[model samples]
Target chain A: MTIQRRAAFGVAAALPFAGARGQAAQTIRIGVLNDQSGPYRDISGPSGVQCALQAVAEFGSRGFNVEVINADHQNRPDVGVNIARQWYDQGVDMIIDVPTSSVGLAVNNVAREKNKAYINTGSATSDLTGAQCSPNTIHWMYDTYMLAKSTGAAMVRAGGDTWFFITADYAFGHALERDTGNFVRGAGGRVLGSVRYPFPATTDFSSFLVQAQASRAKVIGFANAGADTINSIKQAAEFGVTRRGTKLAALLMFLPDVHSIGLETAQGLVLTESFYWDLNARTRAFTDRMRPRLRDVVPNMASAANYSATLHYLKAIADMGVAASKASGIDVINRMKAMPCDDDAFGAGTIRLDGRKLCPAYLFEVKAPAESRGRWDYYKLVQTTPAEEAFRPIGEGGCALVRS
Target chain B: MDLFGIPAPLLFGQVLLGLINGAFYALLSLGLAVIFGMLNVINFTHGAQFMMGAFVAWMLLEWLGIGYWGALLLAPLIVGATGIIMERLMIARLYKLDHLYGLLLTFGLGLIIEGLFRNEFGSSGLPYRIPVELQGAWDLDFMFMPVYRGWVVLVAFVMCLATWLVIEKTKIGSYLRAATENPALVQAFGINVPRMMTLTYGAGVALAAFAGVLAAPIYSVNPQMGSNLIIIVFAVVVIGGMGSILGSVLTGFGLGIIEGLTKVFYPEASSTVIFVVMALVLLARPAALLGRS
Candidate 1:
């Protein structure tokens, strides 16, 4: 049969099977699945949906009719898996931007098993590109290894040696600690000691701060995020640990954390990230476009990843003529693998079939009290971690996709 | 592997860390218990109130030049006064209703407070410096402790004990308890029950704010600060029965110590061990380790 004839036949046969009854199957159905209304709500809710819409608008003119569906996974692996399943079962071409790493990884498993494309933007586990790496998943943003390696090794080499970790006690924290420890040891620095505070630990980090102070480590690395990172740093200051010449290195701080801690406390802290608001002219332009959309929360790496990944997913669907051909999950995914994604976050990056999306990361120094002219005037670019050496060594990651 | 069969420094340090976490848990759970005792209401907003206290203190220092000492006394009073207004206006009506309504109302209040704070200050924490006097670390042979952290633990413990004493031993506490048990009788006996209820809520909320002030120096002051800790406190309250003041305090401190020890022995289970213990406790006796049946 001719390609055109076969494609027409496939659509005719798949029409009755599509989720939308009587509606034309010409529109590309993409699921912008994320944690919308739970713990991760503020991080990846309506803004994620808007990101998907922007992608659809940008990719629509290039021969794709896009439809986006947003859902709150509530940080539950089961919920995220179910959402992906439902979207796939209901004829969604791809699932994009599942944020919580556990949930994102779970969705990737479902997508791979079901033969659908899962464009991961929210998760930060290196496993998505390593042992747990799936042919069907793409970890588009920062991972623990990338974050730790960039900040830990570089900072230690720059004389911020002797480390104390104030870690959030969980899988993420463990991963961060392990990766950062590797970086520190590799950089000829000694890890003094560490303390693990429970997840959602109450307001007092006095004890952890005390432990960090007692270590007298030059750098107190906070391998935590959200309020936990904020609190630990705050308490460290209160105990005068920082003033006593102990510098802080927040391994995974978001812009929101900087804003919350205010300029005074957040100043002079060196950290690393894949993206920053005022990094370059391109980034500034991107943030300018995303500002009205994000409202208060500045476009962090996660949001940027979401925007870029969603755009790339739609472009892949259009390129393969998946919607018109009524292609199954694996067909759509294979097509996505063939396309190159060039976006504002990573400039120009290709999706590796093994799911490792390579990107450059930057080391940022929180501006000193004197350096800051005003509020939001927080970080100054110190150095950029070259993309090649920014992430975990492929062989060491244990990702099945990497060949020995 | 070093000196003793176990590393003495490691053991000592872990113990110190345990004591420190225990102090925070005791202070937070103690505040929760006080709120529950008199208001008969689980102030879901307690964590938010705590966050507010820290923010208020930070603001006092930043905007008004009110130092740590001034904020320590003034911040809680400001929060307490707000609580009084909240008690008189909204919480007073729900006294006769199911406790769940109070929880829901307080939860709504928490959302509002968190949203406002997030909008105003953003999510990053504002650092509150420790006073110069408490800046240094004290060396013990085994493990060095920061002077400020040691002070936090001591002060929180004292505060917890004082609150327990005031509620369990004082004349005002006696009248407060009577009003809680039999409002009509207490009113007939010339004690204004409404005023007592309002004051109780005010006091209960004040404790939460007090904990906040104590925490401000340790944790960066942020909007979502209370939300994160609040859930854990809820779990703490559930594990410790909200009924008895002493039970809550003991359970809070005890669980924190257990959690710290778990980190040393079995690192993986450290985060989840508390919940696991809570589950086991629930299975053995549903009223919690120290909860009243």
Candidate 2:
């Protein structure tokens, strides 16, 4: 096993520099915003732009011209809001694929304020569909609720009852832990304890791991994403926490993380996602087409969600005419929710009133090193969670539109 | 069952882990201290060089089939030679200028190097495994102490002692110190002062790379790995008294323990404990703990 982490992020073709401003309604500008240079970079980076462009390409230039642009949020809320405002002001009809839940929440507000559409594909916080959902926004892919249900509930059912969390002290981490812990408790499992470490720092997780191990919880849920998740998992083995028969649950692991953490280390890690590149022939065909544009990086669920969401958004635009779609971002979102959507990546799904996308979330276990397969063939599907059972019910989310 | 509501073994495990972390801090800060002391140049590129060491090791292992032992021996040499080139080509020109100039130049260089690596490797980072010889952990009841971490601490202490001995007790060490104090006097005494300074800078860079190599297995070999640890290492060097070699090593280990303890009690404050200590140190002794006023 070689450490050839071939970055799927193609040399950042920081293209479409502040695209031409004239004839605003004629062009449908889509801005793909997320952490392009920080820990979450590979999770969606320029590859998101590539995925968005795949939608534009498949949709073709018929009724309206679609343009995909991207920028780095640097994982900061302020930066994310600023870019969202700029894109909205400069005639970006919709913004998509923003990760970093804090940043995603920040941009969600800006999209609402500026009257532009936001389709969140990168962030994991279920609050986007829950208390904070906006009429102008749609929570495109997987959320914490689904992840918790698919993984935490499964672990509980499998007899790993007690839980402890090593959480990143942030909105995303907090929500993930909260959501997962709810499942563990609701399912008759008890949460022994949890440690909240400072985010974007705290590289050494040995102390936290020690604390978790001492709790002797049957399950140790990592309520963090990106590098924090990778670091915690890598060190978990080193400390022999996993060998002690304690189950490790990566609450928000992305597909890219499996390879980066190495299958040897990531082996047996159970995760939940709505989309996998090798799920079916259509997904494979989609990956094959999008691979060249992405410089051969495999499509993670979020990036693929960008394409799925974008295609659905474009189809809505075509169905309602570009003028009407451009008239109001909320109306566009409403049209999206009203219409059922289907694509090669996520298959068929419908956006709920609370903005949660309906799709079957799959439970997967990371393939061991000896599970001989090519690169990117990391997951083995364990169970399929149908749409209604996959995500939080629309009635539970206190979204004003949903309640009304 | 535990002291102060915490088990003795757990506390000891945390301390050991902290010390292991301190080994890295000592190795990294030791390099920064040497560079600032000898060359009077604030090497902001120190982190980039450290990252380069890890990357070079990964490259050697993946591409050249070099094992960890080979990387420990050769990664620093390769990264250090690049450091030599950097000093000769860019840093040598700013020796007489303001310190800010060197800092800015090195800072910019660090960004460029990090950017280049990020572009090529992407930010998620690659995994470099623990060498086979040191793969397993010793079941110490309280905590499973990984043999790799023990190895890291041992290697770091040896390297730090050897570096201190070379700089403080030897003839070349005296010559290097004299050149830092007064280059003109050293040059007049038939010693090539510029060559000595360049080599000193190279050695410091190598030390950083050494730490990077040591860290490769434990941390993911990513471009951002060095950047994350560098700021704290600088804080360690500052608290250790800029160029005070012994101070840097001592403070690095001390701060690591403190940080580790903070994680046990309040993880939210772990990253801040060092900065808090640095602030207190600055207020208490402007010249730092061990620096000569």
Candidate 3:
């Protein structure tokens, strides 16, 4: 070979090496921000980040690299927004598992402004895809609308026509109560009244329970989540509210809350969710893979949704190639909407144009102590709403993305 | 059936519920009053210690097969010992500084303790079953009352009264009172004021923990349990004035009943009723309801 040809070969080899180095430097960073040390910690704290990492592992990182980082939003919107802004400036492509509605909404706005993707699996507010819908945000898992509809409509159908709510005083609680009340009224039930308790502060629900009892409502719907939900249910049992012919409806409940309240007291309480660990073979397999990493706590719907959403988000990135980085969050989200999402956790689902992930929502009754077979075996599925009917219709949400 | 436009049964039921809440308020505030009146140091870790008490009960049951009755006797001791160690290692060092320093130091300690527990056990609560003997309710014709709840109120009242008598009527309490007035003189007169201070702090923590053990059956045994009650206890201390033990006890129960009545008449203000009363008390008397200027 001529000396000039040998030199050309050397330059060509070094050019590929330089390109690989640049690609390596652009590792896709996914941030998981949620309550890590507060009341919501058990619901979606460090376990949420673990689920994301598991997704990254299962996705194989493809030809590129992926990294998962997390922070404790401490259930504060300002704290969540600051962390999101910092992560976005640091080149984080997506943020996930924001549980609290207040914090989730704040982070959603930040994602929109920063043009970064946000996959929310923790929050329950339908407003995410409603008036506050963002092109950069995709709300996965369940929402208040689904929860109220499944639990409320089912309860009303089962002879609970009069309702009173002991609600947690917050945006999440108000949305839950409003949505559930609408469903109840729509099903020919009447809402007697509702009393709001200070969130994360009121430990004693005896007074609230007494008032609920006096309302003469057959169904006392608890429109709250986390420890507040557990406390209200336990106190109601102790007061024998259920024994005295009043049904306690938990509008929003997690597996951990059921575990905390125990099957004995929590039994017969109706709740709604998009995922349960022991649902089927696929969900069981997914839970089996993630259980060892979860420190014995079964993956709640939020954490399970984290795994599914992260897997799908990675798939979308893989489909978009290296240009995924240059593409705006809306572009990636639009691509995600264009693709069908099929995963072990949620089975077959789709991301609607309004950014609401459509999937089946299950109405579950807490199992009696005699009915539970093993650890974390708490839920008994009563009914399942199909994907098309599970969430609010895309056109009904009034999203600017859908309108346009 | 209507009493002033409200159902008579509802009125009575809420009052019973309020009395139960007041019992807890009185118990916790009395402990805070005792410690503040004696130590001149605000133990911010009182809530964490209370949480520790509940966890100790849970641990005893889970680890050693101890029941709730055994836990009722042992959890407070374990929690008291923890307080003594905390007092010796961290809180005692801040006694020479401003009272705010003591507050800040204990507050940091509280955060550490609470964080450690939260890390060990996630924030979701654990169930503590009521004893089989106390599982039923009392049908008083006027209203139904859970047997366990009624027991809690009676025991709490007895505990608060006993604490008051010991502090106001016993020889050691007089020594404690004297030490609070002039520690240097008490130290010079052959009494170990520092040691008394440590014991007093531990006892106060034990009192809070005792309340926690009592609470475990009613409230879920969780890391943030003490934190939820501590703020209300602080408000109770302010309204009752940290200077008077009896005043703290009475105000705790009084405001509890008032809060219950508020729930019946105006459900919206139940949570803030105590704080609102605190503000009014501060406006009328800056030192507190019974606090000395």
Candidate 4:
């Protein structure tokens, strides 16, 4: 009786692996791991999965059966690492669209170990392509370098020369503050001072704001994103720091952030994002396609990058044989890097040697309340940094892949 | 004059900022202390209820066009009624169980409520405009004090005082104190101790909701907002002498000031300062600063 019972349990355990083995070859599972309920949910969460699904539809999957699955990492590195390992081990070919930087770096390690593609769209840390760049990962969306150049450098050039930063105390915030400070000082602007507040908590930024104001900087650069960015901006207005002609530079503002801030408060704030739905006809067409899928949510750069990255990944799969692509993640990443990236969402762009996606970064000035048009129309384009200069120079990135 | 490398004016500004934050801590911990004193159960749902208060205020504005003034009154009442129902159906059953059971149930309930709100609104946090009457700033000698912030501190102090009075002075307050000490005796005396416990729970939840309404204008009215603040407030309650009314109020403000000063001296340790204090307080006095033996 014991032998029979043990045999039955053994068979039951092996059944799932057998089923997984049969489906692994013909299936392409893209796992969308992101901050589904944390601070980044608005910027990119459930909508990111929708963009991935939209990518599958637009690409048409060719011959393989494509499935998109998503899970919330809760913005923790351990949680993200576990999900990434589980997904990769269970036949997931790629994991895409993680917003939080710590989680992004953690999952980047997991993907390299498991030999699965990681097309990052949401994280802003430049370390993904610098010291921590993995052969399995592609840094797809806007990074700290692009944002600091577009918003930070642009503001400095426009005569907001002196800057103070209210930086979130985390990997993402530290990277942004560092990159922007470098650009600010590089552009002959003086760095007044900065306050690094605790992250994921410490919502009351009154003391930090007061400190920045007292620094008497020409511009207050907010080196944080999501709800932290929204709160600081809203509170800064309440403190009337903006009223005294100190320009507020939102170094990394997502579309949903401006949406949440409303026009009256968000007006006159300058920010940088790689994708805007209202930028051009192609972007508009892409938005129209995604509108029905996303359900009343405006598709921001994060969402657009998910769509662009997924489509390009699928296209690379179509170019290279499925067996070869599945056999090595590095090969697939190299193929993706080899191909010129063209999509309706981001237009024409190229994947650099350092695994960074090179695309034009737009400097957008938030329209004044009176100058606003309608809903979701928050930005008026100020200037555009071209695709070639939009990202960091490969030599300066300290990426081993690029250096060799 | 400068102390510890920070200028005096900035130090004064940080102190004032600390007081404003203390106002929130005082109000939140007062409710927590009251509930723990009467019910002997940890109120983990307080954070979710606070979040509900903010969401209700947003709903009243978006759905019914009610302004901030209207929401200040209605949000608490509505959330308090829900708390009463929650106490009756769920929390009341666990009165005879261990503290662990009460904690597990309420923590699970808090997660569910926060999840439901996140599902509906998403975690990006909705915007609530500052009230028109309290919009401008007062250029103080040290800093620019937003009128709304000052009003928040004033009203929070008054409300904390009022809550303290009702529980410490009145005949109803005496009955509440008596019921907590000897519920069976109080019930035998025709005091209806069970009803009082239920009402105390409701009132404590209402206090959290009131704080939420006050916070809606300043902070992000998102589901995670309460959870983020709740941990610190719990630390405040623990340091204040859990279940001690006056202790919770005083420690709430005191810790806020300490945390504020920490932000200036070493902002890296700002979030950790309260927890460190909590650990020290627990080690030195397990009963808490004002908690009875």
Per-residue C-alpha lDDT of model 4 across residues B1-293, encoded as one tens digit per residue: 99888789899899999999999999998888899888998998889988899899999999999999999999999999999999999999999899888888888999999999988888888889999999999988678999999999999999989988998999999999998888989989988888999999999999999999999998888888889888988888888887998999999889989999998888878999999999999999998899887
Best by DockQ: 4
When 1 and 3 are scored with TM-score, the better candidate is 3
Model 2 root-mean-square deviation: 3.7
Q: Estimate every model's Cα lDDT from 0 to 1.
A: 0.74, 0.89, 0.86, 0.89
lDDT of 2: 0.89
Tell me how far the alpha carbon of residue A385 in candidate 1 is from the true structure, in angstroms, after superposition. 3.5
Question: Which stretches of candidate 3 lie above 4 Å from their native place?
Answer: A1-21, B1-5
Candidate 3 lDDT over B1-293, as tens digits, reads: 89879888888888888899999999888888898899878778888888888899889888999999999989988899888888888888877788899888888888899999998888998888888889988776545689999999999999998998898899999999999898999999999998998999889999988988888888888899988888888899888887589889999999989988987777667778899999999999998877787
Model 4, A166-205: lDDT tens digits are 8999999999999999999999999999889889787888
Q: Model 1 segments beyond 4 Å from truth?
A: A1-24, A36-49, A57-60, A159-169, A182-221, A238-249, A322-326, A329-333, A392-404, B1-20, B56-78, B81-147, B150-171, B227-293
Could you give the DockQ of candidate 3? 0.62
Candidate 1: residue A172 lDDT (0-100): 74
User: What's the true lDDT of residue A343 in model 3?
Assistant: 93
| Candidate 1 chain B: 10-residue stretch with minimal lDDT | B1-10
Q: Show model 2 residue runs off by greater than 4 Å.
A: A1-23
